[model samples]
Target: MMNNATVFTEFSLSGLKDITTKNRVILFSLTLLCYSVILLVNVALIMTIILDEKLHKPMYIFLCNLCINSLYGTAAFYPKFLFDILSDTHVISYIGCLLQVFIIYSYASCDFSVLTVMAYDRYVAICRPLEYHSVMTRHRVAFLVGFSRLVPLLCQAIVVTMTSKLTLCGSQIEKLYCDNWSILKLSCNSTTANNIVGFIVIFFYLGHNLFTMCSYVQLVKCALQSREGRKKFLQTCVPHLLCLLNATVALLFDLMYARYGSASVTQSVKNFMAVQFLMIPPILNPVVYGLKLTQVRYSLLNLCRCNKQVKGLN
Candidate 1:
């Protein structure tokens, strides 16, 4: 007799495994509200950047990219997630799982990449003020944006492609959303290539963060000597650091939890760990940048004031 290996065409998400109907309804409402806020704030910030001609600099440009990418990343998780919150079955087709893995993972990798570019922009603005305009010209800004997006996307495409080739034996993913590590764990085949590439991607992730940290160190050294430098550092660099820390910490939590979290951990904790990166950063980044960056803050306020005045006049 020949033994046939079990194959799975779909996966069950056990993150919502034990919730009652009342809890599910409450969770769905809360999730919808969160997603709504995320869309509203990010969209507002993006429009504030686009409409105000004065805000059309490298810094604002990159910040806009950050907000847009936040939406991109969250879209991967939120719609499907909201549906799953109400759903009793909590199932996803294999292809759907792969799509989620690609979008969410690429979003994370790209966030780091954009932050690194933004860090370089700040360094040049503060440290090499004389050449700031020359260095971060329109062409260069465009190139940096493309580089930040393309490299991460390309890397994630490779990872997700590798994942799609695997023959999964188990059909249950323990976490809230589709994750590469969870899928990899399900594979009966050797994950040597996936691990190697995943580590390389992680190394590059760390590389982006390390580069940003070093740049900020140099920035702090430069800012101490001058009042204007200190102002710029406070106004701009501080928010960037907040965003960096927020996204990095959130992503690290998810990554660590996905690969090494104890199965005995409570499902609620697992859900939080799984979704923090997706939930927090998308909403947080735009709000932080909007409040902390003066130009954007003023523009947003004016935009709101103008809208109210128009309403009154109408």
Candidate 2:
């Protein structure tokens, strides 16, 4: 047996090992297509928001941050995933695995943090319309955005740093990608410190969810009492609600699978549960906001029409 101080150099990812060579090609093509669409829609929405002066509002600013985060989160996984699908070997360097753990978890943490801020933004907008401008000022919005990004970066950095110091006994990870928990499971020594910190991070985000729910609960109660409030709720809050729900479900699926998923479960099902978070939110978020938000939809249409006109003139 390796001693406690011994370091592992690499890990074999067993998740994709079940995939046959013939199926890998098919899966690779489909994954490439999905990744491309995610990139296109997210980048398009981000650029649309950036270019249009009309969308320079607090709400749209939050939405833009959300889209940028989607891009950031997906970039950590899809490129390496696509490469792995084509290659026969499913291995990641120890350092590379730790980096993936940091990026993936931080991306998730950032999502929850951003959503919590968005909920607060909506709460202030609907529940305190007169004070919305004063409360969600440019400075405040910038601060909130920075807080959302920085907190996750810091938290995940701590988690990853803690994880990297541990002496790992195993080198086989049973997942499609490197996950913090999976890496933790490989430790031969007691992971009490890891578990405590992990729970703290988990509970921190759980509080974010609770805060969001409370905000929406109050927002819904206020919206119920007025016609204009209902209109605003339907126009603005519904998309945010949809996004929150999507993210919650995706994260839950991944969490459940990570904690209690069984080998008896069909590999296909297991694979779906594993990657659903990566696949769904990155693509669906921009689509939901783009279609549901009137300003964004109109801006996208105008941008397309101008492109077409320029092409015709050329």
lDDT of 2 at 304: 91
| TM-score versus the correct structure, for each prediction | 0.97, 0.97
Candidate 1, residue 148: lDDT:
89
Model 1 TM: 0.97
Candidate 2, residues 94-184: lDDT per residue as tens digits? Answer: 9899898888888889989998999999899889999999999899999999999999999999999999988888898988899988988
Question: How good is model 2 by TM-score?
Answer: 0.97
RMSD of candidate 1 to true structure, Å:
1.4
lDDT of 1 by residue, 78-188 (tens): 999889887788999988999999999999999999999999999999999999999999999999999989998899999999998887778989878899999998887
Residue 236 displacement in candidate 1 (angstroms): 0.3
- Compared with the true structure, all predictions reach lDDT values of 0.92, 0.90
